[model samples]
Target: GYTVHTVLEYNYVLAVEVNGSVVGYVQTEQVFDSAREEVAQRINYAGAGEESWTVEPSYQIAVGEQVLNENQMADAILESSSSEIQSATGLYVNGELVAVTTEGDRLRQELDNMLAPYQNPDDPNLTVAFNKEVRCEDSIYFTSTLVPVDEIIGKLHGEEQGAVYYTIQSGDTPWTVAGSFGISVDELQAQNPDYDFNSNSGFPVGSQLTISQAMPYLQVKRTLVSTYQETIPYETEEQQDSTLPMGTVQVVQEGAEGLAEITQQQVFYGDSSTPSETTIIDRVVVQEPVKRIVAMGQYVPAENIAYLSDGSTLIWPVPAYRGISRWMLGAGGKIHGGVDIRANYGTEILASASGQVTVAGYHWSYGNYVVINHGNGYQTLYAHASSLAVRAGQTVAQGQVIAYVGSTGKSSGNHCHFEIRLNGARQQPRDFFPNK
Candidate 1:
């Protein structure tokens, strides 16, 4: 079907068809030593006494319906020669040959091995066939597929977004550099595909590392500020004790402002004199009708006290304890039973515990008192109250407002007398309030 003409110095052998057409050619010298020698010897014998053998140059061939151009044909011939060389010597380029060695015969052999099956046209099992239909005049035309060059180029370049640049500085490592800019090591590698951090010379100093900027979501918050005012009554105790003339002083009628009488006395002598040693005896309140009154002993300084035990001490039932006639319990005499919380009229009184209101009405010496029996063997009394909001047997929670502070019965001034009794025994109120 075909004849081969071996060329000596050119290192090529030509395959000629029966019609004297040169089908293809291979490089014989680039193949194996034995094949090259045999080809050279045969050529010498065949052309003995002749100037040269007439060898047709290579021509294009139609493999299937697709035509292989000159360059593709030449590549195919080179690959075939490399394959033959590999099969003969069990090595690409036949080891000592120089022609195929310059053209990377080992790499060609690898590619040939990879593409060998697709190169064969005669073997049905080795070839892959694809049919494409074309429209003709009242007929269907089928031809082999021709892939466009642009499509091949497009396939070479894959789908991916581009990269950004970040400069490297001192104390920078691959991990730290990527982490500071919020990028992954894999992404960094993809951005600069040629980066070789392992090699010292690959990424030089002052070089930029390409990365992608990271984006995140956020939220907003609002704040505000304001201010206001209120009026509260103020009272201070006189520092000293003194007596003033108690005769009825003339009150000023309408449109008359009275003048205040001034008097001072030495209550403490020499080095013993202090600010508390003397007290104000009389004071005047200037108004539409001016009035004046005599003041006696200064009120005691109010100090917050705590009981040493586990309960609160109660306030005495009387506003002032100077008039206590007898003691109800033992031989303790007519001593004051409870402390008085001096509050202005209508100050709210709170319940000490969660309990039911046992007594909320009036009593002889106790006045308009309310007694609450707490369930845990504890009871509290609020006496000298102006009014009670809770009724008898009504349930009350702890810290609930029950009444207002007032001087209702045998009391001298407006105050709340609070008392706490545990299992019918009086206990000090300061024990429960450690900070007071």
Candidate 2:
């Protein structure tokens, strides 16, 4: 309708037009369009009538052949890209995912409700857990479905659950067995009440042990008290009694055994027989021990008395020429009243000369013996005798058997204790004997 012509502006060629007889540029090549063309294009794209076109600019603008504004273009570009989003609940067992659900919080709440009855009410920190591995975790994925909490709970408590059994071996303790089964020692002990752990031979070999990892996954602790009673041996007590004969011993009172009681306290976890902790609570003697009593004799008799002098010579105490075992004075300067003649245990003791038995009884250091009175200033003494053949007031001649040689009283060995007494005083017997 209107004539258009080209005009040169610097390097761009412009299209000119005459509108209402006013010359105006219609467009500049690769640069911009005239105001009339821009407004008209906007009006056409918005489908506005001439009346609205005069009132205001359109909400949309056209760029090239596409009909998109700045805000609309940005929205379209953003919509073209995509990302993965996962929102669901997951059931993880032993760190492995086993199931998933859309409603994670709901499933967890339901599981808690189901497990509430089995939870340890007394322990606020304790919670119910599945016998097997099971837990909920948040996961990322595209899509997932919700699983019923009841179904999962059924699987936890149902017969499909696994069980563990252990055969007791030598040197195996409940603690070790439970550890192998992935359980606590107390748990192992609580289930096997019949097994005796007090003895050294614990849980006999080849015995079968049941490990409890069952439903209502809760651990129970128990206190086990063990009592040990044993006999304490009584000690022998030797009591020296001077009244008893030197060669004799008698038991005054019999010794009795005593009893010792030991009490122990132990703590165990769950059905376990093994104790996690053990302590000795009490150890005492229930009955005191009665010591054995033995009585010994210590009595000395007076030497024989001689008044008149007699021409009686001494003879050998034993038949053979037995050498003297000890002298009157011992190695430590201890005074020995009689000579020890080396003789066998039951050797005969002969009377040195014609004499009468003056004293016959147990002597403190003389053991068992008899003293002979020769009726002279000289008197021979025969001590440390096993048996007294002649009694007091009995007469005996020379070479007559009066007693037997023995290791009695304080005698160290079997020997004849011989000595010559002058007026009841000790003297060397060898001095009186021609060949002692």
Candidate 3:
């Protein structure tokens, strides 16, 4: 219902006839004026002669032509909408064009397969679906285009703008970078072949790494109404006791962990790379926690361990182990006043010098620890012990087994935390040991 005009040659196309003789042609209006003026001069030169001109129409497609309307301009070329013309299946994610594949059955199968991993065989209440509504649309294509199934899937999983390079910055580890870009480490290594992923060393800063992945356009969302038991941590309570000695604590009751029944909705998106998130629907405590009760002593009793001058010097607490993982003081005067001696688990921890056990109990920083006072305003503390061989107010001879080494409290591994305090002040123990 509209007139479609096309220009073959836009420059000049006008036929000029002077006295029935074909002269030349001009296309523009200004050029036509000049040709007319020449024709008039020729007419004047030859009296009784007539001059006429006719516009020549050309119908050719070129840069000067305006054929397709604004609506059809996006196609760049007009497509046939006849009954004989057919289009393939188009995959769309949340109404966006994901891909167009020739095999509709295969595309639909692939979409169904994505949801298979999210299905729970045991849970009837589990609902698995696409996080973004995805569909293999039939015959929605306005153009004659068909992509291979593999290519369609690749494009569907790739970034909309294709591959890009990301500059590695400070604190940009492989895990953090991959998570930020929604890519996996294997995908990262696929592009960077030179990187040794097995090594623990980090990549250098100011380097460029290729990032070429996106979360699959269609994400399988799994929602399950689940019920599970949760743990309730016990609380610690301390009471004052005047009958016991100072720097000593006695446990009144042992603590026990409690349980709670929680009903929640577990929502997981995509594969195991992404963890399931929980939303508590209902919660009820099955068993209440029993608080840990300990009695803190206020009095230092008149009774004390008798002193003997048989041994006066300090002895290596952990025998057969000479590995000192850390020192008491570092360069530039960074002082922690304690040393970490690495040893096997359950290794004997001997008393450095003869003294009375002042503390043989649990501490927040030093678990199952022991502290001995050696009468001359000097004391020694052995922390992170597996078990105590001596208790508070008990006497231990020099080099006697007082405890066993263990990785407890805030320790990283099996190590003995040793420290010496002079009148309640911590001192450097580097010079106190016999070995250099």
Candidate 4:
């Protein structure tokens, strides 16, 4: 058996002593099968004072295959194992071993879910098979765990295409949701067949919206035929009656919607989650539409009907008003829905046209305001007032003093925020004041 020993070069030696007296020295490279026996023999031959050895300062030594110092041993270990080891997952497709996920098996579930939506119950040939294998993972201290589902599905579906879908939330618009998905508003509208951005109030809350980077999955062609009953809405016809006063309408008959049968064949393509194409094969209208009729009267006394001319007209609402403070849109071109006219504080706010006061009181953004209904389906509004001279349902003539303009609620300064409405829908105020 070998024994532990301190090593030295030609310039350095081990001092030997016996009986507390220095005697001779031994080189560090000199190996001994037995250190005790070797040291005793040295002491006896040199007549040392004590059987002991002294190592000089700054001496280096090795214990077996390792350095004696902790730091030196650590440095040796690091230098031997400096190369990085990678941990990857072996990917298996359709039970046959395929490529390896450069990252790891953590993304297995994500890929599985993306393929789930494309599965077809009618077609048994379409299927998805995927799995992961972990091997030689000893050296990797940190591993990548996430792989975007879109990226994985893109590979299987052919080409680098992806999809993003989300549920509609409160305060979400087509523009906003499209932006969130990194697509244009027009593209989003095209993806959905039933949603009409211009006419719709907005997407109903919790409805799912899909945005795809490319066509999804294999093309699945199928045909469907069905027939259903549809509602044929009633039509209204007006008959003039001289006996009834003008602006009066009477329903002579109560009309109802008629039923109609419709049968058609359609060709559908792609998965149920998001169909790629649909074409009508045939269509037939089994029942004809019915018409509805209504009667209107004409005969108005001149004193009762107010008119500036044959058509409706509007006047400046604020007396002693300055220029237009703000247009019908805000700073960033966002819809403000009304115009703000600069006026003196508490200046008399006059009616823009002869009308009945439909609304008069405090409003959220308009503050103390008044809305006048001008019998001809036209209306005018005066907002941000200090006091009101008219109450709801009160009729007033054109240019009549209705309220005083002031900064009451949600106003920056003294101004009259004016708006013109037709049948409860806001219209351009300038359109009614063509000569302004």
Relative to the true structure, candidate 2 reaches a TM of 0.28
Q: If both were scored by TM-score, which would come out higher, candidate 1 or candidate 2?
A: 2
Best model per lDDT: 3
Report the lDDT of model 1 for residue 235.
Answer: 35
Query: How do all models score by TM-score?
Result: 0.25, 0.28, 0.36, 0.28
Q: Name the better of 1 and 3 by lDDT.
A: 3
Candidate 4 off by > 4 Å: 1-310, 330-334, 434-436
- The number of clashing residue pairs in each candidate reads 13, 18, 2, 10
- Candidate 4 overall Cα lDDT vs. reference? 0.58
Worst-scoring 10-residue span by lDDT in model 4: 134-143
- Mark the regions of model 2 whose C-alpha exceeds 4 Å error after superposition: 1-310, 330-334
Rank the models by lDDT, top first: 3, 2, 4, 1
Candidate 1, residue 403: lDDT: 81
Ranking by TM-score: 3, 4, 2, 1
- Candidate lDDT (C-alpha), each: 0.46, 0.60, 0.66, 0.58
lDDT of 1 by residue, 283-366 (tens): 444323333322333222123222324564222222232332222333321354544667767766666566899999998776
Candidate 2 C-alpha lDDT tens digits along 31-135: 222233433332233242332423121122212232333323222222221122244556765644455567677667866665565455676434345444567
Q: In model 3, how large is the Cα lDDT of residue 403?
A: 90
